[model samples]
Target: MRYFLPSKRLGFLLLALLLCGFALNFFMQAASLNMDAMSVFSWIGEYYWLYLAGGLFFFFLLLVFSMILPSVYAGSAVAAVLCIVLGIVDYKKLSTTGEPLFPWDLMLLKNAGEMSHITKGMIPPLALAAAVLLIAAVVWLLFKLPKIKVSLPLRMLFAALSVAMITGFVSMVAHQSSLAVSMKYQNIFWNQKVNYKQNGLLFAFAGNLRQSLIEEPEGYSRRAIEEIAAKYSKLPDPVPNVQATQQPNILFMMDEAFFDPTRLPGLSFSEDPLKFIHEEESATPSGFLLSPEFGGNTANIEFEALTGMSMYFLNDGSIPYQQKIVKMSSLPSIVSILKERGYRALALHPYDETFYNRNRVYPILGFDAFTSEKDLDNAGRITPEGYISDKAAVQEALRELKASSDPAFLHLVTMQNHFPFTKGHNGPNTISVEGTSPSYKDELETYTQNTKLTDEALAYLQQELLTLDRPTIAVFWGDHLPALSAGIYTDAGWDSEPRLKHETKLVMLANFNIGKEPLNTLSPAFLGPTVFRLSGQPMPPYYKLLGKVQDEMPGLSKQVLIGSNGALTAFTPEQQQLLDDYRMVEYDLLEGENYSQDLLF
Candidate 1:
C-alpha cells in the first residue's frame, strides 16, 4: 500500500492507463450504433500512434492538474467525468440527427427548449442509471485516493506545456498534416452522417471545428462580380403583352417532414395516405424534388428555394439564417422580385417566429409581413397538437389573398407534422405498416396519418383557390424527409441508396389550367425560376442563368447532378464557370456590396 500511495511514478502510470481506457470507451460509445465492440481494436490498429499520443498528452495534463489538487484520483476522475459526458452527448446527437456533434451545435444550447420533441426517449433508463452509478464510483475513488503535492512554479510550467501541446496538435490537424490524412476525408462538408460514421465522433467534431469559418469562393471580387453580371445579364423572354395576361397570385407551402413513405421498398400501408397528392400530380405539374438535406435542416432548403443558392457551395452545418443574413439590407429572393412587380409578399410560418431567426430574415427577404405562431394564435388559428395545422395555415392564407386586392405572394411553412411521431401524436393509427419491425409501426402510422391530413388540407386549399375570381398558383413541397429511427429504414431495406433517401415529392397546382408537362426533377434552388416560369413572369438574369443550367442539368445537389444527357458526370468547365458566377452573385447579394442588385432584382 505504501509503495503505491502518493508516489509520482505509480500515480502517473495509473493516470495514463486510465486515460487510454477512457478514450477507447468513448470511441466504443460513439461507434456503438454502427460498429461492434471489437472494432476498437481495428481503429487502434489503424491509428495506434495517434491514439497513443492523444492518451499520453491527456495523461500528462491530468498529472499536472493532480499536482495542484489534493489527490491524483481527483484530477483523473474530473477528466473521466468530462469525457463520459461528452461521449453521452455525442451518442445522443448521432442518434437524433444522424450526425456527430459539431462545435457549432454548442452555440445552440439555448434552444434546448425546442429540442424536446426530437430528443424525447433518446437516452434509455438503463443507460441513465449506469451513467449515474459510474459517476458515483468515480467520485468515491477520487476521495479514497491519497493526496500529492508539487511546487507552484513546477505546476505552472507543466500547465503551460500542456496548453502548448494541445495547441500544436489542433494546428497540425487543421493544416491537414499527413498525420491527419485519415481525418481529412471525414471532415468533408457534403455528407456529415457518412463522415461521422467513418471517423469517430471526436475526430469528426475537431475537423468540423477547424472548418467552421466560411471560406470565400474563388474569384470573389467586385471586378469578377461586374464581369459575371455583364456576361450573363440577358433577361429571360418576357411574357407576351396581351389583354389576357395577368399576374397570378403565388403561394408556396413548405411542409415539414412530409414525405411519401410509399417510396420505401418492401414497405406497405393499409391505405394510400397520399391519394389526393396522386390525383393532383395526375392533373398538374408534379415530380420528385432532390432536396439538399436529409432528415433535418429545414432552413437550408428554404434558403436554397428563396434565394436560388445551393447549400453545396456553403460550409457544412452552416445556418445562413442565423449566420449570414445578419444586417444585410437586401437578399436575392423570389419574394423581392415579386414585390418589385406589384405583389404583396408575405411570409407565414405557424411555429416559433424566432426558431430560425425568420422574424428578421423575412424582412430582409423582402416580405411585407411575417406571420408566425403568435400571429396565428391571435388570429384564432390553433390546432389540437398546439401547432397550427396546414388547414388552419391555408385558411389564413386564403383570408389574406381575399383581403388584399393586389396579387399576393405568400410563403407558408407548415409545422403540423414536425417529428417525434411516437404514439398518440397523430391520433389513432389509420395506416398499418408491413414488412417493417413492429417497433416502427406506430411511428409510420403517425407519419402517414399526418401526411394524409396535410394532403386533405392541400386539396381543400386548391379547391378554395379555384373558387376565387383571380388566378392563383400553389406550389407545395416537403422540406426534407422525416428523421425516422434507423431501424425503420434498415428493416425496410432502403438504407443502401442515399439518392432514394433524399428524394421528396413536389407539386405545382394552379386554379387556371397550365401545361401538363412533368417537372421531372429539380433542386430547391431552381424552384424560384420554375415558379416564375409557371406564372408567366419574366425571370432576372441570375434566374435566367439558373434556368439555362437547369436546361442542361435538371437536378443539382452536392451528391449528384443529372445532366441533359441523362447521365451523372463531373461538372464540366462550362458548368463550373456557370456555378462560379452564380456563387459570386449570391455572395455579392448576401455578404458583399450588393453589386448585382440591378441584375438580380
Candidate 2:
C-alpha cells in the first residue's frame, strides 16, 4: 500500500526505460553495428555528443509526461506487450540492406529455440543481473527514502540529480557502435511503454512505422530482380505465342493520373480526349483496363501491366533497388522474353535515371537500352518546377522508336501531369492552365483544367502515332487517380466515404487497320495478357497465371489485401482464395515452411 503513494517509484523507472528504449530503437533501425564493442565504440565516437544532447532532452520530456499522467505507467506496460506481439507478426520486414536487424530492435526472442549465441552466450546473464540489481535498488530506495522522511525540497533535488545521472549514462551509451546493447534496451523500453496494438502488432513494429511515416525511397532490390528472372526463365506451357509476319512497332504510354471516374457506362467526361482513341480508320480499341492503385506508385501499376503479375505475387516488401529485400520476377522477365524472341526493348523517360534507380533497374528489368534526362538532347527544357512536359517525352520516344529496328518495343512513361500542376512548356508554344481557388468554388474547374492538359498531351502523342508507317500497338492508362483538390470519385458523384477506393480503366488502341469498337474487359490484370494476345506475342508463365485469375474475376481488379480487423481481407472472395494459394507458395518459398512443385512448374 505504501509503495502505491502519490509518487510511485515505478513511474520513474518506466520513464527512464521508455526514453532510453526509443533512443535505442532509432540506432537499431538505422545504424549498422558490429559484435565487437571496440568497433562499435569507434563508430559511436563520431555521433555520441549529439546523441547525449538528444537523450537529455528526450528523458526530461518522458519524466514530465509521467509526472503529469500517473496512469501512463500502466499504459506503458500495455504498450510494451503490444510492441512485442507486433514484432513477431512482421518479423520478415526486419531485413534491411546495410542494417537489417534495426527494424527488430525491440523484439526479444520469445522462445528458447530462437535464442542466438549472443542471447544464450553472454547477453542473457548480464541482462538478468542488471535488471535484478536495478529492480532491487529501486525497491530498497523506495522503502528507505520514505522512512527517512526527508524534506520535500531535498527529495526533489535528489530526484532531479538522479534524472541527470541517468541522462548522462544514456548519452554515454548512445555514442557507442555496439548497437546490440542499445537495441536490446530499446526493445525492453518499447515492451514497457509503447502499445503496439494501436495499429496491429506488425503496424506498431518500429520498421513498419518508419516506412509508413517516412518518405519511403523508390527502386527495386537485387533479390527482387533475381526472383523475377528465375520466375521468367521457366516459360509457361502453351504460351500465348502469336505471329509477327508484318510486325508492327509497339508503343506503351503510361499517362500520369490518366483515370476517368465516369467510366461507369453513362457517366462520361465533359471533354473527351479519348473520343478519337476509340475511332480509328486503321486502329483496334480495347476499353476499360482495371488498375490497382490510384494517385501514386505508378511503377507498381506499370509493373503489373507489363509483367502480367500482381504486386501481390511479389515478396512482402518494396522492390529493393540493390537486392536488400525482395526477389522480383516480373517486368525484367517480360523484357528478357521479348529479347529472346528477337524483339528489341527500349525504355524512355524524361526524368533523371536516378528517379527510381532506373539506370540500374531498367537494365535488369530487361530493357536493352534506357534513355532519361542524361540522354535527352535538350538540356534546358522546363515545364512546371520539378517535372518535364509529357509532350517532350513523347517527342523523344517517337524519335528513338523510329530509329530502332528489329520490331522494337518502346516503353514510355510520362511525367507532365504528376502532382504540382502549373503552367510551363517544353517547346516555344506553352500551354498554361492555372486558376485561383476561392472557397472550393474553383476546385472543380482547376482539376478539369489540369486533366485537360494531360488529355492534350495524350492527343498529341496519338497524332504523332499517325505519322509512323509501321503497324503500331498503342496502350495508355492512369498510374493512379490524380491528386485533384476536389475528390475524384466525389466530383464524379461516387461514394465519398473512404472504403476500397481503387478503380481505373486501361484504353488500348492498335494501328493495324482494325476498326474502332468499344470492348468490355473488366479485368485490371488482363492488361498484360490481353496486350500479348492482341500483339500476337507469347505470354509468360507468370502472365498466364494472372490471366487465369483475371478471366475468372473480371470485377476484382483494383483490390489489395490490406490488413484490417484480425484476418487479411483480400479485395474479393476470389482474390482471397488466390491469396491463400499464393500465401502457401510464399510461405514455402520465403520461409521454407511449405513448398509446392506447381510453383516451380
* lDDT of the candidates, in the order given: 0.73, 0.48
Off by over 4 Å in 2: 1-243, 261-283, 313-332, 377-386, 422-438, 441-443, 486-500, 514-524, 555-601
Task: Give lDDT tens digits, candidate 1, residues 1-601.
Answer: 3332344755565556556655645463345334455666666566565456556555555555554565556765666566656666766656655656666566556667766654566667798898889888877766675545545665566567767876776666556577677533335655666665555555555566666324667768778877776666755454522223778889999999888988887877788899889887977889878887777779888998898887767776677877668457668688888888899998888777777778888999899998887776554323354456778888988888888799999999888778767666656767787877777778788888888888988889888988887888889999888888887877666677666767788998888776666887778898888877777777677888778778777778776577777646688888877777777776677667777887555
TM-score of each: 0.83, 0.55
Q: What is the C-alpha RMSD of each candidate to the true structure, in Å?
A: 4.7, 16.9
TM-score of 1: 0.83
* Residue 347 error, candidate 2, Å: 1.1
lDDT of 1: 0.73
User: What is the clash count for each candidate, in the order shown?
Assistant: 0, 33
Q: Where's the lowest-lDDT run of ten residues in candidate 1?
A: 235-244
